[model samples]
Target: MARTVVPYSSLVANGSLAQPAGTTIDQSNGMYIAAARPELTILRVANTNGTDRVVTIKAGDNPPALAGGQGDLAVTVAATSGVQFIGPFESGRFIQADGTIEIDFAASFAGTITAFRVPRGT
Candidate 1:
């Protein structure tokens, strides 16, 4: 199955930014971000499940030899109302061949996920 795309919410420099409702966790197909500027991207995951959930950020496959060599990034979100922020990824490590970053959930995740990017020169 294809991965779900997570749209990025750009942050305003001197103004207030509206909060997004975010996308529901797609445990089955996983997720991806069309990362134009990976260094500025950030991912937010809110877990409301009763048990801890693991989220993995798949590494890049650019050099092949380095693919999976560095290992994927795994984050554990605490049970019930836990919120985690990940990213500002190093393009060399996480950007995929299709110019995106892939993300996966170890198991079913309960809650919403959002992606954010800081404006350049901010």
Candidate 2:
């Protein structure tokens, strides 16, 4: 059986600004939830440091679940670089009770992560 999802305000928006002495996006083991039951439209992780950065993003709030031979799901960004994952919002892809998104990175590097999502169900 398929569950029906309620429609929310498509104009709802949320994000965070991480900067030097701003928001430490390092080994603090931080987690951010965009919205409750969100349909993600855009997700971005930007490296604003002067060196390479190792960033890890996990779906949901669990530690990690690797299906393939691939090791820790991570991305390496060069100095002063960024990466964005953008596409049409899907119900199952970004849906979470609070749209939980986890991000971890090396201590030496600095960066900012943000996501744009619309929570399903009013």
| Count of backbone clashes, every candidate in sequence | 0, 0
Best by lDDT: 1
lDDT score for residue 114 of model 1: 91
* lDDT tens per residue, model 2, 1-122: 22212122233436443422223354554444444433434445567888787765544422222222232346687778665443333334333334544455677766665554444455
Residue 122 deviation, candidate 2, in Å?
Answer: 17
> Would you estimate the TM-scores of all the predictions?
0.91, 0.49
Candidate 2 wrongly placed segments (more than 4 Å): 1-26, 34-41, 59-72, 86-99, 118-122
Against the unseen true structure, what C-alpha lDDT does each candidate score? Answer: 0.85, 0.47
lDDT of 2 at 80: 81
Worst 10 residues of 2 by lDDT: 1-10
lDDT by residue (1-122, candidate 1, tens digit) is: 99999998988987778889999999999999885467899889999899999999988876632444687899999999999998888877887777888899967688889999888875
Collision pairs in model 1 = none
